[model samples]
Target chain A: MSRKFNFCAGPAALPEAVLKQARDEMLDWQGKGLSVMEMSHRSDEFVSIANKAEADLRDLLKIPANYKVLFMQGGASSQFAMVPLNLGGKGGTANYINTGIWGKKAIQEAERYMPVHLAGSSAEVNGLSRVPRQFEIQTSTDAAYLHYTSNETIGGLEFDYLPTSDVPLVCDMSSDILSVPTDINQFGLIYAGAQKNIGPAGLTLVIVRDDLLDQAKAEIPTMFSYKVCAENASMYNTPPTFALYLSGLVFDWLKNDVGGLEKMADINQRKAAKLYAAIDANDFYSNPVALENRSIMNVPFRLADASLDKLFLAKADDAGLLNLAGHRSVGGMRASIYNAVPEAAVDALIEFMNDFAKTRG
Target chain B: MSRKFNFCAGPAALPEAVLKQARDEMLDWQGKGLSVMEMSHRSDEFVSIANKAEADLRDLLKIPANYKVLFMQGGASSQFAMVPLNLGGKGGTANYINTGIWGKKAIQEAERYMPVHLAGSSAEVNGLSRVPRQFEIQTSTDAAYLHYTSNETIGGLEFDYLPTSDVPLVCDMSSDILSVPTDINQFGLIYAGAQKNIGPAGLTLVIVRDDLLDQAKAEIPTMFSYKVCAENASMYNTPPTFALYLSGLVFDWLKNDVGGLEKMADINQRKAAKLYAAIDANDFYSNPVALENRSIMNVPFRLADASLDKLFLAKADDAGLLNLAGHRSVGGMRASIYNAVPEAAVDALIEFMNDFAKTRG
Candidate 1:
């Protein structure tokens, strides 16, 4: 049977090739007579796998020499708390740009540790637009860092440019990472949950400048300490071994098969354009976000007639286009087109959407 | 090629049947047309899978209605910090029993949050034995909880009985959680990392008394809050979906094919006995732990002639036995016979040990 295109936000779609390789190697990996999942993290075989995963990810993102790559657990949400606990030492405050749900969550978590400054926000615009130029950024010369969500999944909004700041720039790039290329050197720390564009849900990838690692609050847990995780190569405890292995396969797939992030950016641009064009071609559907600052990864649109929402979802499911329902916060539909989503899948979804619209209209 | 028996401590062996089922369903789970890994956590299909996994685990352990089961991340080590942060609210002390590496780590982490009372300890015995009855278990009537490592994985030590206390009992059951039948009602909280006796390495299982859920410090991250995790059904963030799904398969294997935990306890007892008998039969190899309190899961032994250690490992590898090397802290050989270890494997290991000893002698 043909595979379905999964549009899940996270625990999201992975490259079929990676899944196939994992399935084939589930019994015996590299003639070791044991599955990768079963190998001890201390084993030579697993050590090699873990090291390669980190090295390949660094290469793909062009990570600078001063940054340490850490494979952590508990997803991006966990990092929201960890970033503050590690960076917001003593009574230091940090600046946060609130864009949408993820940004607000990060700000809320950061508030638990120290005073958080809301630098800029698109929340007043319902997160449908980018932060306006007239908006003021509350920067503290003595602040710990500036935090922002590069991509907001639930609200289908994204920041195209990095926040201009002298302070270390920290970002939650959970939804948009690896889908497009970015300047890794500009950020002091960047973290992304693996589900959307990496591999699966359990693993979180953290890249932090080495200079920023030494100042964790004295009371923070060792597991939450960036210094401890970096010192032990993220094996301070038994890491998500299987998740790391799977993510390594994805990194290899992205580099060799999917043609790296440069090519991925090109292809993603095309896919997003096609879907957006289809939505904008007629008045049958509407995307509320401003066209200039629209997100290329997530496109949330609504039917012209609200009554057809259920009908659209049912027909889409029948056609094997799944997880098209938008997050409850927004009522219509959402199509998450991460890096693993092929152009053909988006084309099929557009075709299906057009056909359904024509018949219903 | 035939499969070999693996003895790695964590990210260790899983049931062959579970691995097979996981591979079979990797691309499409139960005709869902999407891999379980790709499904959204909020999807009905995955929600049902998560609910069933929790229900089955509760049934296996006979969990009381007052307890809540939560699937979390960051392994047992993260829980080390989270437990104290949640329970030790506003400057309260908790009692800790130090038996081995895991216990020591727990103490070090807990000290970051609140005062930790060194109640009972066998670390002075080089972790070769469990805590003696004469050891004082200091407890203040106002103590937050009593924490202990039920089975020390690195030190190969196990607690024979619970400490007498009216305070809440919290256990890090990472290494030997389901190896035998457990009285779940006795403990306020029991947490296990799913690597040794469970499924994979990413997911952590926390069984907390419902009444203890509201005790999380408001400053704690929402992801680490027991109340938040319980309210969202462990899907507060995207859970380790693939890990949880595989763990569900393991729960089924344990309950159905393995004749439940009672039968598993008997089989595990027999497996440990066979290996221990070999060590006892001759003076060539010796296990330092006392017999009555020996762990049924991990058995660390050493040769009388230290020079033969490498030779023994090479010969064992040639015989398709792997990961017999002990942790670096202790220099010896360890054979961890967790629940997935079949009787035939134990018999083969015994035969190999006898032959090696006879030849060397």
Candidate 2:
């Protein structure tokens, strides 16, 4: 009857404070007397909302001044094609590290417009449970850019460190962008769908270095053009105004309530540790990902007997741990603990897992 | 202060009851314990919401059974490129009528992928104040489709009836859909950005006849392909879930409170007539659009003395007739009386206009 510990991968959990704030302002945002969705995107009030969201995001990530923050639509899947169309011109070669589903998907889209070279792959590891070390694969010298997915939502494998490479680093940090801090200057470009840690579905955050704007292919669709969006401040057309406004509220919450990315990261680390420890504490549960590469944002594990998965998920749902069923691609259990999934939620999940293993072992 | 009479063109106004419903349910939609934005687009809850939205939309318009309603993104501008890419094929010709800004935009984007024939244009009618009558334009039988904008928001020009032609009709109804009744079988495809009469910005509603799905070119990006979106049930990617949900609420509001499209159209007609009569009451105020082609949704008018425009807009804003400043390209005043702008708002605007004209004269 009350709120549940929602573990849906995405659109995943959102901060309760943010949701409450949004609810309070749903009809009249900032005393404007109209819902934020009704306000024109070009109006001063909505403009302030959009500007603040981008500013707070820049501060939270310490994004470099030379980079442009574009609040776009169409999600990260659109970025899969956009990155290739914008960065890798026709006949150009782009190197992609095939570590998991997200990476493979990016590679597949890129190959449609350009030749993609496999810079590295961890597929040899069972179930793609690890990332290939830096020295394990050769990087192409003339790559348009080196692309990699930082955290694979389904595979529960994450890269602990930036891949060492000479080419420009393009990262699909869809699942782990704000959960951790990174040197923004190191990335040529980074993109993530807003459903994970940003705000909601439909909006995508694209941060691209200034110099990379000129590399876009001439014939690409205007909406998918990063350079054009950067030039026009992402208002080339009517944007997802409400989604952008909500994300701004989230950025504000992360700053005033949670402090900043460093504090949020500490909280995330602790939450992931509690859940992973519960799994490793007994032989009754197992997570196939290598210890170093296990995702802190998404903790996927399985009962010793696959037959118990249905029972595990059904009971978890009854206990208010909703959407715990793993992806159909990797059927077991995946408890996605994004920034909004409070540490208490993870503790509740761990407690439930422990009790279940004890009762059914 | 209570809610203002917001007259913004695209992200215009929403029904008060719909906004109130959204506010009341923002935090716990149907007792789900989370904001709609946090629910996965693929979740059964969201899927139901999406399905019901399309169904209600179909019911309102009496969409032919051969049409597939797709909830998409990128707005109408994206559809500009998608139209040519999907229907006209490479180097093929498509007939486009140049009415005003929106038409020119669609033509520009279409020309990138196909040759566009200008069927007829009102540009010669001083400031594009009219639409070329059906007899004035010649339709191309060899063309893939004939494209036109049902209403030009900025220009305040609207087609009084369907364009007579054998070619399949494709219309950009971004500014005026659901405000009136339409014969769905007359068009092969119709697309509208949801910011106007539907819900909010970002989400685009596409109604495409099922038989046209196979014409999409293979080279277009996945998100732009209507065929792919139709096949995936518009879950081709995480949609603008919040916008879609809000639009569904709007549809429900229309069905239960406003009755149906015919009733809504009657109210809209009365509101437009009241405002137009006020403009024509004296020589001091004048509407630029031809009477027969004037849009019921957007009315653009100019003062007899252009010098009074600024004071007029300022006074109107102070009186809470917001966004009355006409588009820059067509400097004057615009009052977009969308479905959500109740008759009271129109009366307020008309009363204000008459008083202003009398005082200035």
RMSD of each: 1.8, 1.5
Per-residue lDDT of B59 in model 1: 83
Docking class of 1: medium
TM-score of chain A of each: 0.97, 0.97
Which candidate wins on DockQ? 1
Give stretches of model 2 more than 4 Å off: A124-128, B123-128
Each candidate structure's TM-score, on Cα atoms with residue i matched to residue i, is 0.97, 0.98
lDDT of 2 by residue, A301-346 (tens): 8899889888998899888888988887879889999999998899
Stretches of model 1 off by over 4 angstroms after superposition: A123-128, A134-138, B123-128, B134-136
With a 3 Å backbone cut-off (N, CA, C), the pairs that clash in candidate 1 are none
Per residue, candidate 2 scores C-alpha lDDT tens digits across B1-361 of: 3798989897988988888877777777888777788787888899999889988988999998889999999999899988987886533569998889999999999887777789988744664378888898876657889999999999899999889688779999999999999999999999999999999898999999988887876668888889999999999778888889999999988887999999999999999998999888878888888788999999988889999989998999889888988887778889999999999999998888888887876
